[model samples]
Target: MSHFTQLRTKITELEHLVAALADVGYATVETHDEARPLRGYQGDRRRQRAHVIVRRQHVGAASNDLGFERQEDGTFRAWISEYDVRELGAGWLGRVEARYAYHATRATLARQGFSVAREETDRDGTVRLVLTRQATGF
Candidate 1:
């Protein structure tokens, strides 16, 4: 499969893997949200809300199992599943889940103020993109 295709495929797999783990006890499912367009807009306007769940281990309802830290240009990157893994339970799936988390994070960040500058496949067929931070309040 192509790099982007591979990434996308792996991303889809990880999405399920995350939930499966939560179901089996590999990890606790935190926030699982589906982002979709809610209203009319100039473009494809959409949003995502948290879908909270657990692996029968946690006592309280929590948020997304992922964590994102903003880069210098405002692009947020993270292997958030790994974060939750330590607190919960994660294995090889952590790495894959991280990809899905990143995609969701990128979208959410862009709406908050960060904008993706470019996205292209690398020489090795790997995908990469740039996101910049602009004064979105203005």
Candidate 2:
């Protein structure tokens, strides 16, 4: 039996989401143009599908696959098994979200010709970034 739970998230960009996963140590995440099936506890394919997936092998021996589906509004929704959630703990998602925001902000700033002048993280996991842009002469 499958025990996947759907969770909504504010992640709207696929590239940022992938990069965020990598930043959080999930380097082998799979991305597809269309949603693909997720595996269950027994390595059986479940009916649920997602555009971005972290395979069961990467999660744990007893854990099911982790997935993120793209929504109509361009955001992604997470589909994580209840078993995996307990294994990963509650803070797992929060960390991913925080990293997502970090990457998104950095990418946006880079596009605007801004460079990261300083970056730091507190003991409490709070990230601070300082950006600067070169002055253009007329």
Candidate 3:
């Protein structure tokens, strides 16, 4: 039986999601055009699938694959096992969310011709970004 449970998130962009995972130290995340099966704790493939996956090997010896499945609403939801949640801590997803927000904001700003003039991270893992845009005409 699969122990994975789906958790809703506000993530909508794939590129930003991948970059966010990388920022959180998951550099080997796999992305597929189609959903792929996730590996269980016993190394067996479960029916659960996702577009973005962090393999079981990367999670832990007894942990299942961590995944983000794209929903019909254009957002992505996380699929994580209960055991893995306990091992990875309850705040793990929060960290990923913060990083996702950071990347997404930066990308949006860049598209609007805004550049990061200053960036700071506090001891509590809060990120502060100061953006500046050039004047089109003076």
Candidate 4:
């Protein structure tokens, strides 16, 4: 039986979340205002409501949608089918979270007048970034 599993995330801004998903090559549909029912493998609507929908265009003939719900504390949680998770690849959520963090961090730094000085990706896909604040002459 396929079911949606909620995964916790620290994403608050809908725009950032959407941009982060896109940064990692995900097709997303924002539905924060109108919560949509998540469907199962048999095309049955589940009780879970999604603020944002992550659509897998190539998941078999029927595209599967992953729902992301907003928490009371302004965070977000994702509801995804276990089958689709495996199909996307191992540690799919972890990868998405990491990419989201990367984009969010970069945006924050840019807003603070900081530029990326150096970036390194470890063998285990851990990102290390060096940010340098721009100097202003008096």
Candidate 5:
């Protein structure tokens, strides 16, 4: 028996979520306007609307489907089978979120003509990113 688990996330933009997934090596395919149920092993399914479907190839042999649903509040939530969580490790969400943040921040800064000046990761898993913009003298 497979049950759909709701993994709450702070991702509002679908592009950011997709980028995050790609960053983590999950190939995603965009679905249509209507939400489709994610099929699972043993005929388990969820009647949820998923904007993007993360292909099952990442989880080989399992019928577990992973997708993202948009909430009324505009944030997106992860809809995945419980089996995937167990197989993909409990830190899956964290890893995705970290990537999302990384991409989002980089995009935001790039739009403002800022580039990464320095990047470093500490022993405590803290990342320090320094941004810089070209100086234009009037």
Candidate 6:
């Protein structure tokens, strides 16, 4: 494939991963140090293997609703917000926080939707997975 196609595929794979995360009640991202203390979930720092991270019900000054950005320092950021969350969060994502991420990614990927083939709930109550994609007519 061409370079652009490869890049698009990579992006879609990453988006799919994130959308799958949203289907549950969690995401895989981090926030700025300044924004960190504001979170309700000051989650465990140990054993998180992260490249791109998710932030639900958390936002920043320059954030776009359900925004995606890559820092020069190489962190991938993804999120859902109050406004967009209500529109996309659904089905498995039954909570307010989950719904926000669902709706946010839904609009961001009009032609594509997320997939959840597997969900493993750890002893710590964290869900890890290998997500795919699907086409929903709703």
Global lDDT of model 5: 0.79
Model 1 spans > 4 angstroms off:
1-95, 121-127, 134-138
For model 1 the local lDDT of residue 87 reads 46
What's the CA RMSD for each of the models? 17.2, 1.1, 1.2, 2.5, 2.3, 15.8
Write candidate 3's Cα lDDT for 1-138 as tens digits.
448989999999999888988988788999998999998988898888999999988878888999999999999989999998889899888889888999988888999999999999999988888889999986
2 or 5, greater by lDDT: 2
* lDDT per residue (tens digit) for residues 26-95 in model 1: 4655443432222111222223122333322242233223322223453323332223444445443444
lDDT of 4 by residue, 1-138 (tens): 675677888888777777767766675465668677877666777898888876545244454577788888989888888787777776777777877787888888899999989999999988888888878999
Clashes of each: 1, 0, 0, 0, 1, 8
Model 1 CA lDDT for position 50: 21
Candidate 2 residue-wise lDDT, 1-138, digit = tens: 758999999999989898988988789999999999999989898988999999988878888999999999988999998888899998888889998998898988999999999999999989888888999899
lDDT of 5 by residue, 17-123 (tens): 88888877776566546677776664455575587786566555774778888889988888877888888889888988888898888899998899998999888
Which pairs in model 5 have colliding backbones?
Answer: 35-49
lDDT of each candidate versus the true structure = 0.39, 0.91, 0.91, 0.76, 0.79, 0.38
Which runs of model 2 end up more than 4 angstroms from their true locations?
none
- TM-score, candidate 5, is 0.84
Tens digit of per-residue lDDT, candidate 6, span 43-128: 32322222434443443333222333443444333333343343444322233334344445555554455555676767754556
Q: If scored against the real structure, what TM-score would every candidate get? A: 0.26, 0.95, 0.95, 0.79, 0.84, 0.22
